[model samples]
Target: MNILTEILLQAERTPNAAAIVQFGRGSGCSFDEEILCSYRTLVEQAQGLCTRILRRVAADAQVGVVMGNSAEWVLADLALMLAGCTQVPVPLAFSAPQAGWLLQNCAVVLTDASGAMRLQEWLETGLDLPRNTMHVVFGHYQQQSAAAPTSRAALSGPDRIVKVVHTSGTTFRPKGVRIRRDGLDALVSALWQRASKDDYRRYLSLVPFSLLIEQVTAIYLPLTSGGALLLPPADMLPLGSPGVIAADRLEIIRAARASALTLTPALVEALAAQAIRLAGRADALHALFGRPTAPLLAAGGAPVANQTLTTLDQLGIPVYQGYGLSENSSVATWNHRGANRIGTVGQPLPHVEVRVADDGELCLRSTSLFAGYSNDDPSSCIVDDDGWLHTGDLATRDSEGFVTITGRKKTLIITANGRNVSPEWLESAYRSVPGVLHVIVYGDDRQFLGGIFVVADRSRADEIRLAIADYARRHLSEIEHIHTPLLIEHSPDVMAQLFTVTGRPRRDAIAPFLSLQKDPSVHEHP
Candidate 1:
């Protein structure tokens, strides 16, 4: 059955149950916003959107979703599915040039309140589009007299492409991964099954819905399971807020009484710090959620440091790390909440097969894998003959089937002495040092390994450096020790360089900086 049916089924079972809670921005709405329509509201809204979209575009044509994390974003996604149109989620952080590339690639586009203003600005500036391309704003434009392009009679089956999500574009040019309905169904079902096992009740979403994984877990999974989604408060800062204190996130958890939350490594670190600041008075926070003192914290989007995990664990949070790329449709392998290993991403989820190549690269096969990349040849990303999605991440599996990600194969550093070092390992170790916010390890084609460290707490920089040095000396061999930690005062221009959202360092994009920093005159230390 189609994935959209899951929403329909949930609405039928518990129409009054809270479906979505959108926080931040100006408006806040609960599941009861349209009480009478209930679950039918989702179907009706999507149907309205679908009817409007299909009137101007082919059934299989791509429609871009450019918005932040909000209810409008979720509605647009469901509407696209019901309309049988391929949805493309454009990051709200995308620049005009980047947005233009996606717009040119897709046949049609949709923008929500958050993104509509910017898209209009770009469009009014005379952004060129294909002759037949169309762009529509979600709430702004309701009626059009244009002739219908294709009727529902010509619509393809559900197995056709449903959505397209672009990669973070850190290393290479951004590429779109095309997701099909069947794949989404499998993913949503697997997530619901897992949530059922864990008794996942309330979901609090902070990740932008533009992400495919966020779409599945934060939106679809909750709806499928007949659970509630608690959103952040309207005054809460965005994920990258300069003043985003732990209290900000704590308020959301308390307000939503959220039992489940998914966040990036950075947010995890921040939340851990907040927990510490609470000084063990977590009862108010815990009580607000109607959950035990411990909450299930699932972290993805980046590799979390062991120290951060250990800290959160000590603070009564169950931390689970998982690994997935846009190509695999969000999560191929995840650490179950109760069945977690300290440094591993846990085991492969149900119906997913994960194996390590002879070279230690992780390979996966799953029903949730994307159909292919858009605009380019499908084979360029997915080699259909192998039936395995090649995850560039290198990993090692234990006898118990737990997977520990070592590093990205493409980012592995080969020292001048021919020893292979996983920069991720070094960076993970560095984050254990207090006051260090971000660390990038580099020694490629160099005599020794070194790193660029960005410290959030500048006052403790000296102390952190000394502590890191002591830790490295105690735990690492001479080769693994960084000769010196270069402290960066300013954040890297990631967006300008097209590295990542949330300002995470892109190893590939920083390679040039690494090369320039390496001094050939320095001799290797034996």
Candidate 2:
């Protein structure tokens, strides 16, 4: 069955139940809270939008979606599926040039109210978008209403192209992944089968709905399971918000009474911190204020550290971590309640087969694997001729079948002496140090590992430095010991370079700083 069928099924089952809650710029709207939209209303909106989109573009045409996290974004995505266009979700944090690149690459473009404004600004500034390609703004496109006809009908199966999700542009040019309806169906079905039998009636989403992972789990999964999806207000969890703060997210999670939440590791850290704070005040706070409980919390995108897991456990929140890439429909392996391991991403979900190569590169075969990269590149981004998705993550699986991701294939740091080191492992170890806000390890062609450290609170630098030294002495080997940590007064300008939108470090962008520190002139002068 197609993923869109889930929405139609949910509408049939519970037409009056809440479909989506969109947190907007000033405030927000909820289907159940403010404006009551029966599932039928949502289905109709999708159908109307689909009719309008297909009128302008062909079936199997790639349609770019440029919008922030909102109900409009979700509706546009569903509409694209209904219309038989491949939906390409561009990162909202992308620069104007990046946005233009995506638009040029895709066959047509679709934007919500805010994205149209942003795109218009870029267009006025001379970003050359394709002429034949039309732009369908989600709400109230004034000047171009006469350009296209709008209708309300679903497309035939042969017309559908489910999605074309772009990879995070960290090291290479972003590639658009083409997914078919069957691939999406397999992923959602696998997830549903594994989900708790108890009703997952309410969900709170923090990530942008444009992200395929969020699209599948937060929007589609909830709808398929007959659940309510709540989005946080735009201002509270803005794209520009610092990646580390948990207070804003905790507010939404509590307010929505979200039984399930999907988060990146950065958000997971914040959640863990919030959970610890709650656990710390559990006794006194229980008497003064009633404690709120959320049973299921799942985190992915990046690895969650051991410390964070322990903290979540202490807070009585069941936090599970999963592992996947955009090529695999966002999840291949996940840790669930009964089969969870502390440091592993857990076993592969049913019907997904994971294997580690001799050199430890993780590989998989799954029904959710993409059809191919957009533009039909023969040099596959993931799938080989044999159909295995070569996930570039280096991992280890235990006897019990738990998978632990050690590092990325591109992220492996080779020492000048030929020793292979995983920088991520070292970074995770360094973060365990008190007052270390961020750490990036570098030793690409050097004899020893060195790092650029961002101290959490500058005033406590001396104490932290000493504590870190002591911890390293006790825990790490002489080679594993940090050669020297250069302390920065402030966090690196990651956002300025678009290395990270959230608090997670962009290791590749920061690698150049390592070269600067390693320059021989400084030591020669000394």
Candidate 3:
């Protein structure tokens, strides 16, 4: 079942209902200045765009999208799906060379005016593009005399590849994940089944459209449920800074009256800090959101600290964290409203089976499993003979079925005494310390664990170090305690090298930068 069918159905049944709302460029808090598209108009425009794209590309040919999250990007994605063309989405944050590398495998690339200009600049810098690759700017999509195809069945089968999402692999390089129509349909079904029955009137899109999680929850989930997708202006929520993103996101959620939101852990942490500042004033918090409260906030992409979750709960905004990967078509386990466990990423969704292997790896079998990697066969990379996708995450499932992720399989630290440790638990615990911004643990072959901490202020380094030392003494065993805490300078370059796009610490990428710290101290304070 093609997902576009749902959009068409909504158009036929409820033509006047809002399908998409594009917020205008302003202070990021203006709902009066907006462009609203009805269901009928959305379908007509998508069909019109589909008519133009079919003339340029063959069936099942790859179509690349090098644009940010906006109404134009949404239309292009739907047009490709309806036209039976596989979409290759490129995030705006990717470098010109990285964008070109993704475009090399595609038959056509679609972008807005700015994206086309960026590509032209890259070409002038001697970046090569495949000779057969076609470039189609969004505004130039002319309505041809030929009739547009309404359904995808005429061009491609449901089980065939429909989209290729590019994500960071274990090697820290970009890799393409292929997803099919049936897999996407299964994912939508699982999500709808897992979520509460309350109808979400407006859903906010916070992350980049290139991300698979955003593509599903932000776009597909809302579409299937007949909810309006509220997209902020391109300049309002830039991905450059976490602080800016959190501020803009809060403003838009209030202005748009969004009933649902999916966010990254970094964004959640930033918002938690803001919520703490607004704690005592109920009226001010109500005025900030415009309503008395906001909607359900679902977080993912990284481990959300217990402090962050508790702070959000105190603000009257519930947060449910989930665990998923690009290989599983976005979500495998989620803590929905019904069965939300505080610390664990909730039970497996419908039709998804999860188990822990003997070696502490999480294996998943789901109907929504990705087809395969773009350059490698499924069997070679993750999928095993029994059809389980071996997620490289170390996790444990409780008797009640909640899954707690410990760390990555490739990031386990082994001491000389042969004790293995996962740093994520310790990092999360350290985050509970006030003023602690980031922590990375390292002790591969050493006698004791040591770490680098990025704090809010250099003067408070001693305070944070002593707090962590006391925390380790109370909670951790002797073998797991981190004896040395090294304070480091926080800079943009340091963050870029140490963190992934979703704000998860990349242990291997951060290992080389750890040498910048000159001294490590064991706190004498209790």
Candidate 4:
């Protein structure tokens, strides 16, 4: 069944019940305006927008949705699904060149007025668009009173491709992952089943809707459960940089009294910084995160430091770490209320089958796996003949079935002595330092490990370096210890090029930018 059908059913059951809550932005500690959209009102808005869009484009044409996250973004998503058009969610992180490549064959591109203006600026900057493609602003479409009827015939098909999601990585370009209706449905169903009963009342969206995990948890899960999808006001925090969620933005969660949140590792780090400031006091934690009310705080995207998780746990915040990729449809394994594992990324979900390959790479088989890459890229051939998707992530599964991700297949650092070390563990250790923004370990062919750090305060570089070195001494092996440290100030421009859209450091691309300083230890080795 089409996922839009789930929303339609919910609208029929509780037409007047609040389906979405939009918080208004203000400079004060507490928000001022709260706009609630009933199920019926949401459906009407989606239907009207869908009707307007269908009139403009051909059947099954690709429609690019580019906008800042908001209620309108959610409405546009539902509208596109109800109309049976393929949606390409363009995240703000994508450069004009990347977005152009993804939307090459699209018939129309939909965006807010501000997004449209940005597109125009890109065009002036020499971004080439398909001659037939038209750029349209969503605000031009008006909501109608009568709901536009969904044509079931247009949506039903054996080959179900609903959305083309783009994956973020260190690759030269972004890969478009084709996600089917059945896959998304299965993922949402499994997540809803694993969700905490106490915290399932509302799902808060802190990330962009363009992200597939945010799309599933923030949009589909809430719609299917007949709960509210809470969105922060656009003006609450400025958007532009990747992985830079404002510390004050957490106030939206407290103001909304939201229960569930899908947090990126960077956001978890931000919360960790706040917790440190509050000294893990119960009252302060309650004031910042709505402790007793917030239950399902799942962290993913990157490896959240164990220290950060410990801090959040001490503050009475429930932080569940999960592991997945775009190929596995967002989440393959997760820690839920029933099975809470701290360091490991819990057990596989009911619909997922996971195994450790001979080489220690994680392999997965699930109904939610993507059909294929949009360009038929051979790299998508990670799936072997037997059907297990060979996830490049190296992992280990315990007797209890909990999977601990060790590192990535491509990111394994081989030292000159032929000893292979996972940079992830070492990087996580450095990230645990309070002022460290990002750290990239570089010692692929060197005698010892070295790294460059993007710290919040470069003036305290010595202090940060000592803290990391002390942590390494206690937690990491001698080979994994960082022998050389290059500290750079935390600026958006510097981070934009050094880090991927998902906040992972671009190690291969970063070495050229750093000035190498010979360590006394490295000279002794040679």
Best by lDDT: 4
Candidate 3 stretches greater than 4 Å from native: 26-31, 130-158, 170-173, 196-199, 240-245, 377-381, 411-526
Deviation from native of the Cα of residue 13 in model 3, angstroms: 1.1
State model 1's lDDT: 0.64
Q: List the candidates' TM-scores in order.
A: 0.70, 0.71, 0.75, 0.75
CA displacement after TM-score superposition, residue 486 of candidate 4 (Å): 6.8
In model 4, the Cα lDDT at residue 336 comes to 80
Number of backbone collisions per candidate:
1, 0, 0, 0
Candidate 2 regions with alpha-carbon error over 4 angstroms:
23-36, 105-107, 130-160, 169-172, 197-199, 238-246, 280-292, 375-382, 412-526
Provide the global lDDT of candidate 3 against the true structure. Answer: 0.70
Question: For candidate 2, what's the RMSD?
Answer: 11.7
Tens-place lDDT per residue, model 1, 273-392, is 766776457473464344656556777655666887887777667678877766777887788756789899988888689889899978999888888776563223444487987777
Q: Indicate whether candidate 1 or candidate 4 has the larger TM-score.
A: 4
lDDT of 4 by residue, 1-526 (tens): 3466777888889898788887776675667555467887887777777877788886588888777776767888888887788898876545566678777878888876555665665566577964443444334455554445554544566657789987633332457888887888788878877874346567778766777888888888778768888877765432213223345466776777777877755567667787678774557757666665444788776676687787778766769998777787789999887687788998998899999989998999999999888875434538888889998888999999999988877775644322345566557767888789788877653535667788999889788878887766454434456645777789988888788989988876765675453433323121
Off by over 4 Å in 4: 130-151, 169-171, 196-198, 237-246, 276-282, 376-381, 412-526
lDDT of 2 by residue, 260-322 (tens): 767656556666665566565645223211235554777776566697787677666667888
Clashing pairs in 1: 257-289
> What lDDT does the true structure give each of the candidates?
0.64, 0.64, 0.70, 0.71
RMSD of every prediction: 11.9, 11.7, 11.2, 10.8
